[model samples]
Target: MVGAMSLRPRILSSFVGDRFLHSTPPLHQLFRYNPGSKHVTLQLSRTLSGLTNLLFNRRNLDELSNNKRKSLKPGKVSPRRPVPGHILRPPYVKSKQPPGIASGPEVHDEKGVEFMRASGRLAAQVLEYAGTLVKPGITTDEIDQAVHQMIIDNGAYPSPLGYGGFPKSVCTSVNECICHGIPDSRALEDGDIINIDVTVYLNGYHGDTSATFFCGDVDEEARQLVQVTKECLYKAILICAPGVDFKKIGKTIHDHADKYHYGVVRQFVGHGVGRAFHADPVILHFRNNDAGRMMLNQTFTIEPMLTIGSSNPLMWDDDWTVVTEDGSLSAQFEHTILITQDGAEILTQC
Candidate 1:
């Protein structure tokens, strides 16, 4: 159970005149989602856009020159498509506005637990189906289209769609891009690595999970990084139990990543998810001052992003995509988890 001290403050603060909507980053700027009309609007800066464009083009040119071959850059944004009539869309999707953030983590009762189980299972199934499509010469937009239809066929909504203005159903982040990489028309080449993040809104709740997949034949360094990244998630999950300091999750992850000389991304942390796509008790991936405690019935996620170079990430002009500052390879894995009477239950596990 969440301590009494933890419950009241969060609930009260969350309900105090829509401040929660303004305080937290609109939607999952770090993970996924666009803000509702009620949220604060960020003004686009022309100067910033110009600088970003220059840097982006320079980076692409450098990559092409180094390889002595053409490398693909993310293409034009895909147009939004409509969900099937039978699938239930999220409030944000229906209203085209920001869905207010959840006040706190949901302490699932008997019924709530079952809903989460079903949601997690469906999300995993969708991710598995999408994984089969990863190969040389396929555009990410095509991948998104397949995933979108699959979720609709199952009578579930692709959580990322229209949530915070994300154009695609699934997130397809490629090499050098840490997370939140939007799906585009870029054709994946042989030896490239991509991370497919899938989250589905089903039965009134959301289940989020992601995994890094290799294209054709990946190099030794890339393979090891992906394997180690998965191990980091497993080791962090091992530390989850009642009364354990939440900060230890970061410590354990950092320890494992450090041993291999890999960098852990700090800009984005795993978050609580349920009725609201993202919620309270933000889970950091690096050791820090957060002292929150895990308790029974609390549901959250622990998705760690690891890079082969600098952990620092830079935001692209588009504001949603995040890439490594040093342009090194990155890999990530995510699972929605629930705190139980004895240990953590991995709801998103297939």
Candidate 2:
């Protein structure tokens, strides 16, 4: 019977074995029994013997020991590092101050943290108001107008307007545009996705917040990207407690994005925002775990830009607007955060 017969064996070179199309290599020769031959019966008997029995034998495989994962759970991270991002106690801007004046090493001394916190709050309030205008048929310019007036009404300047000479009151990125989306004449359409990034300087403090919203009838991919991107931001935020390292924040975010196969923007990073707007700590949100650490009372934002395709981004000629290179839709959410004694607190939460 076929089951009792010995299977033939063949040898293949490395290159031929690596080639996938040809399932089995061509055999140079074949064995056969000649009835006229003197030892034909003996040869037939030998051929009938199963090769597996001739070799080791047949056996059922147990669960693979080689397939086991190294660890069933994530490991604990070391608390201390050789180089950690400095978190100031009182919080101050990282600009040149008079030589004699000491901004506390761990925290800035001159009340700059308070100002930064205030700015972040104002930015959050502006974003919350701006989000209300995100409906179909509304021109981005009108949204810009509302944001401009809102900042002015609050008696604070819109940081994006005239920032490096930018023209809009806030950034209104749509669809493929990743960051610094310009507020312009384009009208909102059904199924359109947009990100509104707002930063305001109120009473000398900087508050920044951003959220991606749907215009009317958005697609599944865009909606999921926005939802997951927002979640990744929160995941990174939750890890922003005092004594936590900066590199780990990106590590957590990148791991989450990897699970969804979303692209992680690499060019732009979260920064220290207190007195001068963007300051000292440059927070990079990717797995390279070397950015630094968070100390008590230190403050910053962790905004992750998750993409549907390529991670590379482009900037518009206004020298302000940024977009994705592949034209795939992108989404982002940001919140100014404060590191507290026990854990990190989101200053712009809500």
Candidate 3:
């Protein structure tokens, strides 16, 4: 799971007869038509009014129709699944409290690097297996069950299970959900998109990664959003090396997402993952000038969240689930990487 930055909740309300709202067309007419596909693809034109924009601090939703598909509803979360007694668990499991970001970079020696690679490979393998079960009728809870079994079968603990009170072993974010979506009993439908985040703890190290998968036949616009979100992650990774300014990651991701007019989520960020679930040097996905530098042999994750509509997030009552305020689709991709002498090595690859 990606770590979240502290944020204040904002009130959401639309004022009728506002100049900006009046000037904009209805949600249905705001999309750009593609002659090849019957579906209309939305392109954000302007942000909401000044007052509302400042209050929400997100793009104008003038282009998004409030009457889009039904908003995602929370389903009943299953009882917590048990792990085998023989499997070693992370320290946080016993505390039942969130172990906040540890205060240091995860720079590793040669032996530590080997351990990191082992955990990362396990995480990637579990995630790959979880993707194949993303069909129309399967519940996210079922996917969690499979992932949990796979992780323990390999003698590793599922990292998200007890951290910060997360109920499930993995995170299943569908459609508008930005991140940290708890796996539940809701069955996916055709055209729905889901992001499964998998992390594993092995030999005192942690590996984290995630990717969005199409449930079935997805629309062209949603497909483009997922594709660009992935490109944003790789493009950001390409620029990482020893002595590079960390701010360059934000610029690289923000610049590419701009070409497709996708909104980059700002609150959640990637972080150093090794001995701790979340570690030092918070990695921001949007444009910023934060002061930090990459060091050789250091490790961290670079997951980027991109949206088709407003990047503003509304948390579900469950507290673990986060969704787009406008109910538009959001997609994310993540990978744990090690900064090498020349470039970064992707630790979480199958």
Candidate 4:
């Protein structure tokens, strides 16, 4: 098959905080590691300025030694709409409210958000279960099996399972991999870090979530990357609300990561996911993102994939897994949220 397409180019600041990442041309290279493993590190330069990219040199992984790197046909998505997205399954359907939540603030179409709440709770449950399922001998495929049934048992569907023909239900991105890591026969080893990206479909709507967790004993850098990446997600949320500039979110997140000299991956972005798996109002986590206004009722995921060295990612031949260009550990956290009259409600909440 043809390689995965390169996404639209983006504009980002020169320095996230102290690490001046501004170069007229993005620095790209291929870094090598274990010959039998798919976990290669990268030394990527920030490539988030502009919207046009050639299909052949997507992330420009020239410095790395991997020959399988190639551009992909970018996935097609709706950029904006009056309403954000939903999880209510069988699309174009309504909700059946539960008890207390129905009488609360979400009365008229208010309870409609419950599906997201349910997705969040279940996602948390799944995260909890998946974390427990990790071990030195367990395979990623086993992890996927557990995550898949957890959704079914909760009367929900795994959103990633056929999303744009994505083969897995949960994204299991291990060390050195940025995001979109598919489950495989690979077993966990000592001191490994894996990030699980989960999205559930409930009541016709969608709930998106992701968290990087420790597999066994991790390195100091790995621990810091996971903690700071998650902190960046929450910090980005703090700057989110109605009428807020979308670019500031990235600026704040990048600034925060820069303080630690962390690398913020620029390849993939958090997007609107609700009634549809992925929706309008794409949320970019780096500065200079050409994002529009964050109007009321707008919903999206604010996931920032941070790298240890630089924020560049290169795709493998399978056209899915994305690894850091600098060969450093990467961690990310995501939340599906909605913009309220005041702040924002994390729909995937308990």
lDDT of each: 0.73, 0.60, 0.78, 0.61
lDDT of 3 by residue, 71-120 (tens): 78999899999999888888888865565666688999999999999999
Candidate 4: Cα lDDT at 104:
10
TM-score of every model? 0.81, 0.68, 0.84, 0.71
TM-score of 1: 0.81
lDDT of 1: 0.73
Candidate 1 backbone collisions, by pair? 33-164, 34-163, 34-164, 35-98, 36-97, 36-98
The TM-score obtained by model 2 is 0.68
- Rank list by lDDT: 3, 1, 4, 2
Model 1, position 257, has a per-residue lDDT of 84
How does model 2 fare in lDDT?
A: 0.60
Q: Write the per-residue lDDT of candidate 1 for residues 92-151, one digit (tens) a residue.
A: 785544454466766788888888888988888888888899999998899999999988
So what's the TM-score on candidate 4? 0.71
Please identify model 2 stretches exceeding 4 Å from their true place: 1-117
Model 1: residues with Cα > 4 Å off, grouped in runs = 1-72, 95-101
TM-score: model 3 vs. ground truth:
0.84
Q: For model 2, what is the error of residue 191's alpha carbon versus the real structure, in angstroms, after optimal superposition?
A: 0.5
Q: Which structure among the candidates has the greatest TM-score? A: 3
In candidate 3, the residue pairs with backbone N, CA or C atoms under 3 Å apart (3 or more residues apart, or in different chains) clash, namely: 47-60, 48-60
